[model samples]
Target: MKLRETLEAQEFEPYIHITRGPGDGGHWARQYAHRFDLVLISGGDGTICEVINGLSGTDKPIAIFPSGTENLFAREMGVLPDCDQLIQTLKWGRRVVMDMGQVNHRKFLLLSGVGFDAHVLLELNKFRTGNITHLTYFWPIWRTLWEYRFPPMTVEADGEIIVENARGLMFVSNISRYAVGLRICEQARYDDGLLDICFYHCTHQFRLVKHAWNTVMRTHCRDSMVTYRQAKKIRVTSTEPIPFETDGDPVGNLPAEFSVIPQAVRVILPP
Candidate 1:
């Protein structure tokens, strides 16, 4: 109600949309995006991904309102909705073009993960409910750490082999921050026209934990088991389908290919 009144006062007609379920935001955006100059999306990372994918291949600009569980992308951009900063940005913000990652046919604005992280997401989605909080992730992480059988796969970037027969975890990041503000791919740039890849080749849970700790410390890039680099395209091939996550949403299994769409979307951001 407040947002509607505020927009009305500003002489902007805002259409309030309540998503019916997953994919609704993107559906609505795709249906109505042709009529709007800028679209404001309110939700967590997953919802953001939904809307981003909805607006893919278009020049429409989007403003994010962080109202979801893990507003990681919002924090990365240093804009939290419902604050004076967000209001100021809405009224007077600079437009920047940001790269987006595409996994198969789906698009993602943040990062995408395969193997262990994807498994965690698959489990996590089973219980995702109202007002998702950090606590919603604890059980999934714990269970995935113990039970996930890291499957073997081959990773190639730009048609060159990066890893072969690897059974660890891989992430393709367009933005720097993962959930909890972990700098999993610290050197990533959203507008760089390239995606950053982080591959950890240790399947042991203890070593994985150590690498995660190093990520928390922002030193994982230097670890021996970790491989970090930039790529325009990455192809992951597995003997069987491997689960993958895009911006924290559990996307389908891989034999997946990922590539960047350079400056795919115009986004309003704080200066």
Candidate 2:
């Protein structure tokens, strides 16, 4: 059945807004949120991130209807692509409040990456012309691995320094799992009022490979080189131009401060 038909069956008046370009989803969502009781995002992770940013500072409940984009947040929220499930969720789903992470001035609902993965996303965004599939990541990851030099950075969580001038990838995540199902921040909890930070102390290609293997095996927490912590606020800085990404999109270079907005976003989930 069509979305409009399904919504009408549930006594909802559907309002469809097709995003014209980047940031349009957030712009429109912010502009019109006062008029709607709930907002449904029918796109992938990027689109969902945009809409979530738009809906910040409001009590509006948002629902994720997975489209062609990688719905990593949806995965964490137990949202699926089934039409009947989506429609039923539109009406009778449980309302759960999830934490939102803010880095610099931008808000992210799922995960954020600093260093290596951000470098990979930066390269991917450079050549990204259209919708990308999982296969589209091959060239970017390979190119970034060879080209990216491990930039040194320091991390301060809740005003205490955890890793000082570390060289590797740092993940500040609201969700546990990452790309290819790697539980990069396995201790993350969306409603926990804190952000989980995981750092893989990688200095060479061999160590990077080893860290990846450990992350896949869910044994990185046991490795001494891997650092894991959770806090309400985090400050990451680098004198060098180190990049960072939030919710799979490359945002900007660090000297960024991250903080958690607990019980911020109200999302509908399968009951």
Which candidate wins on lDDT? 2
lDDT of 2 at 239: 85
Model 1 segments more than 4 A misplaced: none
Candidate 2 colliding pairs: none
| Candidate 2, superposed: residue stretches over 4 Å from native | none
lDDT of the candidates, in the order given: 0.85, 0.89
List model 1 lDDT by residue over 122-189, tens digit each. Answer: 88778877666788889999998999777888999999898998878888999888888798989999
Ten residues in a row with the worst lDDT in model 1? 80-89
Q: TM-score for all predictions? A: 0.94, 0.96
Model 2: weakest 10-residue lDDT segment is: 67-76
Model 2 compared with the native: what TM-score? 0.96
Best by TM-score: 2
